[model samples]
Target: MPKDYSLLSELADIFKGKAVPAKAEPGEVAIINLVDMTPLGIAYEALRTFAADTKTLSPYLLEAGDVLVASKGTQHKVAVFEGQEFPVVASANITVLRPKEGTNGHYLKFFLDSEEGRRQLKAADHGRAVMNINTKELSSIKIPNIQPVKQSYMAQRYVQGLADYKRKLARANQEWEKIQADIERQLFL
Candidate 1:
């Protein structure tokens, strides 16, 4: 039999104070936009350039396995960061949730994207036209308990699949470009 994971609220008490950093401009740090995120994962250019003066920005830095939740915009957009050189400077409308001890980032992300999680978000949300959940509410949101090892495995598999898909897509695009180039050469010459 599988172990019963505790409610997300059970683990909330262990987290420290939430951090809300200043927004990052172009060329400062890699930025994650709504368009850059998908159900499976984030897009290649999801992390774009930041402004030169972004160093002055607040605690907007993200680690390899940090969880990024869409705070102000659409209800369901969320993403997790993979390893990269520059840290991610997320948008103001987004909330970055860093897991505390005993909580796994991958498990939190997957749980939040689930049907139960969506319902909880919907219930916690205020505002009539544009539904939104603040950092406080988001922090209070419940998540199921999962083993850290299992979470790591799930994250690894998801990332691997996405990476493979991106590589294949890149190869296909290159092939198409070459075919187009050949046709243009024959026609022009």
Candidate 2:
């Protein structure tokens, strides 16, 4: 048996990001942009931390289960934000979806990463120069009401799969490096 849900907004608190500066200064909170989210996950290498009053950013601050959505970009990517080194919030171009009680953020993340979810996001993207999906549009997107146990199981599988893939990718890169070194030695020495 399956349950039907009208839209994602019903299950979560859908909101847009705040205005962020072009650059961050020292002693400021770290902000997440669309560029920070990659296919692998959130890349913390090029973080931008700028000084902003806590009062202004406190509302936008991300919780551990909060999900970040790319509102303005070529790709529609979604990531679940667990706590990082410092306080982090999504930029104006990203949409934040904080799951309501009885909902799993990781499960929602996996669902939003699915093909159907991408299609919904694509349909909502309405911008002249860049693709954009606003809070209203995101909220209006339909979703299935999956059971809690199943959702958790699915989310766990997704996490495990991602970990396995990363391990394999690292191994492949190491092997390729070794092969390149061997070739270099054969040609030079």
Candidate 3:
């Protein structure tokens, strides 16, 4: 461990997600699964739902600034749960990390997504059949001990840049679709 780095356990409370039974109908609780997570971010549309009383699943219920890291998988995806209007919880495959008040949750997610952070996580992987990083190993991962304010500022800048890029990508995709439609019409004519 580097002198400047601190173990993630020192900064956050780690909790393994509970498996929730699924429901056929649209339900009150949203499940954040591995499929819901992506390199860009969590795919809100990919989230599955289950019927459950929030009171019973209180421990799994996501709070604002909670970081959800994939426990079992090759990617070991990391995402921040920004707290929704309704109830949401991570699925069994995810390990929820609740950073302390002074720690920036987004910064933790960003760090875990970085090359150095990914290397640490990869080194921690030990499961045989299904590659996984256990809670204990994840808790021991090292991260730079940065002030919350500074972490927040840096995270916000990265977020803003990403959002801007996404907007431009969407616009470009729309233009490409329009061109495709024009070509199809010309072929038919």
- TM-scores for every candidate against the unseen true structure: 0.71, 0.91, 0.92
lDDT of each: 0.66, 0.84, 0.85
lDDT by residue (tens digit), candidate 3, 54-125: 899998888988999888876678988877877898988889999987898888988998899999888778
lDDT (0-100) at residue 76 of candidate 3?
A: 70
Q: Which candidate is the best by lDDT?
A: 3
lDDT of 1 by residue, 8-122 (tens): 5555332221223345355645677666777767775655665654456545666666677776665577777676776565666666766667666677777888888888777
**lDDT of the structure predicted as candidate 1:** 0.66
Residue 33, model 2: lDDT of: 87
Best by TM-score: 3
Better of 2 and 3 by TM-score: 3
What's the lDDT for candidate 3? Answer: 0.85
Q: Give lDDT: candidate 1, residue 143.
A: 66
In model 3, state the lDDT of residue 109.
89
Candidate 3 versus truth, CA RMSD in Å, comes to 2.0
Model 3 weakest 10-residue run by lDDT = 17-26
Kindly indicate the candidate among 1 and 3 with the higher lDDT. 3
